[model samples]
Target: MTEPPSLKKEPIGRLISYIHRTQQKRLSRSLSEYGIGGGGQYSFLKGILMTPGTTQDQLTCNLKFDKATTARSVKQLEAAGYIERTTDPEDRRSHRLYPTPKALKFQPVLQAILDEGNAKLTRDLTDEEEDQLIALLQKLNLEE
Candidate 1:
C-alpha cells in the first residue's frame, strides 16, 4: 500500500479549506432526506428564520455572501416551501424574506445538524482549546 504525499508545511488555509469541504459534504449527505440543499442554503434558511422579513440584500450583507449567491438561495428556499418573499412596502423593488411554517418546524432539526457538525469538528479539543480557537478565528476574521 502507498500513502499520499503530504505538504511540506502545515498550511492553515489548506486546513480551513478541508474543514469547510468536509463539513459541507457531511451536512449535505445527512440533510438530503429533509429536502434542504446542503451548504450555504442551510445558513440562508436559518438566517431568514431568525430574522424574518429581511431583504435578500440584507442577507447578502449580513451573511457576507455575494449578491448572486444570496438571490439563488432565496429563490430555491422559496421554491422549497421553506420561505416566502414579499415586496417591501417602502421599496417595491426590494423583497423581504420570511420563513414559512414548514421552516419553523424544521428549524430545530437544522440547528441540531449544525451542532452535530461543530461537535464532530471539535471532538478532540478541550473546552478551553475550543474557546481559544474561536477567539483566534474571530481575531483573524476581524483583521483588516
Candidate 2:
C-alpha cells in the first residue's frame, strides 16, 4: 500500500489511531456473523471467560473503558446469550459475570479470530521487526 502524502510525517498517536480504526473495521466484518460488537466487546467477553465471576466495575477498570461502555457491552453480551450475570452474594448491588455455555463453546473460535486479526496486523513485518514493534508499543503503554 502506498502512503498518502499527508501521512508521511504523521505523529505517532495519529499513526496508532489509524491502525486501530483499520483493524477494527476488518475485525468487525469478520465478527459480524457472531454478533460480537466491534468496540472492545470481545475484550469484555474474553475477560469474563478468563475470570468467571468478575464484576462490571473490574472490567471497566481493567479494560480502561468507561462504566457506561462496560454496562452496554455486558447487556449486549447477555442478550446475545454469550454471558450471564448474577447478583453477588456478598454485595447484592453488584453483579458477577460468567460466560454462558454458548460463549464457552465459542472460546476457541473467538481466539482463532483474534489471533488471525493480530497476525494480519504484523504480516508485513519480519519476525524481529514484529518483536521490536511489540516492545516499542509496550513502552508507549505508560498507564498500563
Candidate 3:
C-alpha cells in the first residue's frame, strides 16, 4: 500500500513542527503561574539569571532570538520584577541585565519546574535514547 500523503510529504518537518507546538503549549501552561509567557520568555529569564551583566545584544546573539523578541521578553521580565536592567556605563545605549532578588529566590523552583517538564517530555525515552536524540537534534539545528 502507498504511504498516505500526510506521512509522505515533508514528514520530518511536520513531525518536528508538531513536537514544537506540543512543547510550547506545555511550557506556556507551566510558566503561566510565574507570569512568564511562552515563546521562550523563560529562556530569556534563564539566560539573564545565568549570565548577570550580559547585554541585551549578547542575549540576542547567545539565545539566537531577534532583537525585538529579546527586548520584549526583557521588558516583560522586568515588569514582573524578575529582572533588572541597568545602563551600561561604557555603552550608553546598551543595558546590562541582572536577576532580581525575587528571581534569585525563585531560581531553584524554576529549575525544578523546567526539569520536571523535560522529564515529562522525554518520559517515553530511555536515558541513552534521550542522549542520542539530543545529539541527533543538535546535528539538525541550523541555528548555529
Candidate 4:
C-alpha cells in the first residue's frame, strides 16, 4: 500500500494564510470606518480599558510590546483623544495610562463591530464546532 503525502506538504499553511488575509482586510475596512488604524490602537484601548492608570512599563510587559513601541502607541492614542497619560504619584519617572471618556463611549460600537466580524467568520460553523475550535486554539496557548 502507498503511504499518503506528508502533512507538511498539505495546503494547511495556505489555508491559514488565506484566512488571516481575509480577516485582516475585513478588520482594516471596519476600523477605517471609525477613523482608526489597526494594531497598537486596538491593543492600547483594550489595555487601558482593562487596567486604568496602568504605567507605560506595565503596558509594555502586559502587551508584550517593546518599550519604544508601547510609548509610541500610547502617544498616538493620547493624541487621538482616546487616552490620557497622567503622572504616577508613587513614581515620578513613570506615567499611568488611562482611557478618556471619548474612548469609553466607543466601547459598545467596537464590541458590536467585533461581534459582527466574528459572526461573519463563523457563519457556517455549528455551536459544537465553534466550541471545539475554541478549545483547540486554547490548547495551542499552553502558556496562557
TM-score of 4: 0.78
lDDT of each: 0.90, 0.93, 0.91, 0.81
Off by over 4 Å in 4: 1-18, 141-144
Worst 10 residues of 3 by lDDT: 3-12
* Residue-by-residue lDDT tens digits, candidate 2, 75-99: 9999999999999999999999999
lDDT of 4 by residue, 1-144 (tens): 999877765475577678867876787788776665665467777788889999989989888878888878788788888899889899999998888898899888877877898899999999999999878867664353
The C-alpha stretches of model 2 lying farther than 4 A from their native spots are 1-7
**Cand. 2 TM to true fold:** 0.92
Q: Compared with the true structure, what per-residue lDDT tens digits does model 3 show for residues 29-131?
A: 9889889997789889999999999999999999999999999999999999999999999999999999999999989988988898889889999999999
Could you list the CA RMSD of all candidates, in the order they appear? Answer: 4.5, 3.9, 3.2, 3.8
Give me the runs in candidate 1 sitting further than 4 Å from their true place.
1-8, 142-144
Question: Over the stretch 31-140, how does candidate 1's per-residue lDDT look in tens digits?
Answer: 78888785489989989999999999999989988899998888989999999999999999999999999999999999999899899999999999999999888877
Model 1 TM-score, 2 decimals: 0.90
Q: Which of 1 and 2 is ahead in TM-score?
A: 2
Model 1, residue pairs in steric clash: none
lDDT of model 4 at position 96: 88
What value of lDDT does candidate 1 attain over all alpha carbons?
0.90
